[model samples]
Target: MRTAAYVLVRHELRLLASLAMWLARRTHGAGGGRVFGYARGQGAMMFGFAFVCLVETLTMSVLLRDYPTVHQMVFVLDVYTIVFVVGVHAACVVRPHVLDPDVLRIRRAVHVDLRLPVDRIAAVRRELRTTHEHADGELDIPVGAQTTVTVELAEPVAHFGFFGRRRDIHLVRFHADDADSLVQALGQALAGAVTQARSAPSPRPDLPA
Candidate 1:
């Protein structure tokens, strides 16, 4: 019970923070990094769903007008539902995938956020996959009904779930609005990371680029 409450509180906090970021037209962590957005595919769907909720709220407000106590309670719940739905979309908008010089950060709303070291990435490609199969060591973060990018890592990376569950992932598939550009940028970053790793002396570490 306590764990569930904590997760709920954490999720609400993330949504509120996301709402602020969305209102400010700012991304969460894209400073000094390339931002790749996956939210475009789901933007229409999310708003459409919110519209449906708005309609239902209106309908319920009229039907429950006879019972003052129940009407007030239902009205509050309906408004909260609308806020929650919109906040989820806002979270997706603000928390985009980020690619630094040495790490590639992939995210989906307030849930998945996995950072893979550039050196550990074996291959990255622009493969549009609408269907995915769940397998051990594979993590798929699909946007809408499809994924536009596929990444295979040379080694496994740890991924933590919303409930604090942990798993080791060797393959990751996700969506990006401009997948070709993301793939190209990742290829260049990987090459640079590899070159730097090879030239660095074992006893002395190279400075952060």
Candidate 2:
């Protein structure tokens, strides 16, 4: 009876662990088993800015309490609400880049969702320069980034930008805290993808043809 009880407890523990993992994945928006990479410095900066905004808002609220006219009250409320919204947006900016087996997904706070296929990548290189001068057909997503990784595509991709403007992009540049490591990992994944495609057998042709 003790042995049977032990096994039952083990099974319940596994079920509970699985439930917790599922909930975590759902909360993180990692539904497809994608790995995440973060811009640590940029995230820190955003959080710091949010904290400053919070302090300023509180100070303003206290200062404006004496002049409680309808107009002044409305202005104060608007300022507080705007700052609160900005802080929330800043918090969301910490969302990491999702790296899938065959794609790199970048999601910005209600601004852009970029999905780049692994097979289409021609090269992944690190740019050490502090400021990058973008070429005419390049799509750049710097987002207050410090380190940079430039991804060259084999062919031009149609990227829809803000305001629904579509443009053909031959290269993409983005920032990451560990740009070198990211480039190395991405290169290895792309190489493996290429090898797999080459090793895949082609469809059989018709005998009569």
Candidate 3:
């Protein structure tokens, strides 16, 4: 059930690729992958929340139309709005605790076919840990051992860490258990992609020849 929540959140995030891609292009000059990832994650979460809000609003509107008097309808709508907002807020706040485990499942689903470039593909491991202050938090991943990859979520934010920076403080964490196999698979996939990209000539000059 918790894993399912993470999958749902990630699915919601994937739906925002168009906007994320657009922003990535604009900020390509900023050299902040972490920033971009954070933005994308937050945007995705907001989009999901907004969708829920719209549905709730519509439902309330329909239900209120059947009320006999304006005072009764207004009182009912106000109460409903308050309850709905509070529930949404609480749900969003608690969502991470349920979804963290699903990250591993998502990691395994990536295409390992021969045609895809390995450089463009990366594998992820998610760790879920309980904290005193919060039930669930995120851990940051360093890209290629040098760059920071941001891990943010919809309701509760996770912890972020880079190699050698505050390493001791981690209580709850997720990682690729079979890291060697994952790296090998990703490397092979990348190598295959590189070969294909190189063999196929392209008009663009900036890309690797």
Could you say which candidate leads in lDDT?
1
TM-score of 1: 0.93
lDDT of each: 0.91, 0.65, 0.34
> In candidate 3, how many Å is residue 73 off?
8.3
Instruction: Name the runs in model 2 displaced over 4 angstroms.
Output: 1-27, 70-94, 145-147
**What local lDDT does model 3 show for residue 29?**
19
Candidate 2: tens digits of C-alpha lDDT, residues 8-69: 55544443443354345432345663444444545566657767766766776677777778
- The sequence of per-residue lDDT tens digits that candidate 3 reaches over residues 49-148 is 6567667666766677676485466656755554443343332222211111112111111110011112423332332322223333333222112222
lDDT tens readout by residue for model 1, 1-209: 34978998999889988988899998898879999988888989988988998998899889999998998999899888888888988999899999999899999999888999998999999999999998999998998989999999999999988888889999999999999999999999998988898998888688899
Number of the candidate with higher TM-score, 1 or 3:
1
Better of 2 and 3 by lDDT: 2
**TM-scores, all models, native as reference:** 0.93, 0.70, 0.22
